[model samples]
Target: MFKIRNIGAILLVFFSISLVNAQIKIGDVLPNITLQDTKNNAVKLNSFKGKTVLVDFWASWCGPCRLANRKLVKMHDKYKAKNFEIVGISIDTDKSKWIKAIEKDKIQYVQLIDPKGFDAKSAVTFGVEALPATFLFDATGKLIAINPTESQIITQINKK
Candidate 1:
């Protein structure tokens, strides 16, 4: 009986480790996910397959996320013509507050809402344990970097 219990514990630990390492990694293809905009319009991530995309998960209450938006706005402007896009996914449960933040930040990128916040299935799929998690993918839909900085994004885009 003790041997069986020990074997069960070992299996549980192995599965836990697998789950911890299940996050999408660099070079993995971006999974096509259909989320919605403020107007409830369906938007698919793979719709922008030919453009370099940065999928950012943020919340209105997160200060760091708000700060990141300020920098991302500038980056988007410089690379918009180069087929670059930033998809801002807000996990804020309050729709009004999320919209206000977008306006306050003067964010012109494609904005989507999860509304479920961290409990969202999309959050689990993206393996987002914290706010300001970002995945930068190339024009070919291959992830190039995770939580990339402005310089890193610039370099990756230039490489393509």
Candidate 2:
């Protein structure tokens, strides 16, 4: 019985550590992940340093993600010239479907393919558990918000 209890305690501690490590909190530097764009060009998350960026994690099959993309499109247009950028990371394993959704949504921002669905490396690193998850980073690549609303994103972009 003592051995079983010890094993249970160890398992609990291991899971606790994992959960803590998975979280990417505000003020944490964005993870350095290299993913491919729609055109198959390698893009690194760190490359966006020196620019305010919104990293959006989404899937083509998610209806809420589609709606969020529409709002993001408008935000992109309004803020692109202001040095704000949006990086859409699709968690869709189907490349064609992901590209189709981008084209249909008229998304002009940088689009990346995760191809791992919810278990994508970036998603796991950032602890993204839901569709339409967004992380806002400052010009220095430090995270500012997580799952922020469209208005909250715009407000952050508009800040000096």
Candidate 3:
């Protein structure tokens, strides 16, 4: 029994290490992954370089995500001309659900799905493990903040 418990502990440690290693961090260059937009047009991250970027990781099923969309839409309208852009990375597994939510919520920002689901390359690159995670970047494309709230977006914009 003791030997079995020790083996289990070893396995747990290895699993934790792998998860940690997979998480992305500050200073990591955003990977250039392209996905179809709500309009079914291909959009790439590289196209938004030299602009302030707000990346929101969400899913169709998440209530907070839906709520956040309303504020995001307003922010998009407010700062878009200032070269600020918001992008939604949907971690939802169902394509229909993602598309429906985008329409239902009237989300005006650019939206994309992790066709690979939650463990998608972009999610890993952003070290995202939770829904409604947000990352803000400067015009130079470096990460400035992570997981900021709705009001914080306003403050950040005003600062810029």
Error of 3 at 113 (Å): 0.7
Candidate 2, residue 87: how far the Cα is off, in Å: 0.5
Which of candidates 1 and 2 reaches a greater lDDT? 2
Which residue window of length 10 is worst by lDDT in model 3?
Answer: 22-31
Per-structure clash totals for the candidates: 0, 0, 0
**What ranking of all candidate models by TM-score puts the best one first?**
2, 1, 3
Give the range where candidate 2 is weakest over 10 consecutive residues by summed lDDT: 148-157
Better of 2 and 3 by TM-score: 2
Q: What would the TM-scores of all predictions be?
A: 0.89, 0.93, 0.80
- Candidate 3: give its CA RMSD in angstroms: 3.0
How do the candidates rank by lDDT, highest first?
Answer: 2, 1, 3
Per-residue alpha-carbon lDDT of candidate 1 for residues 52-113, written as tens digits (9 for 90 to 100) = 88999999999999999999999898888888889998899999999999999999999999
Best by TM-score: 2
lDDT of 2 by residue, 1-160 (tens): 9999999999999999998888799999868899999989999988998888999999889999999889889889989988899999999999999999999999999999889987888888888888888999988899988887778777877778
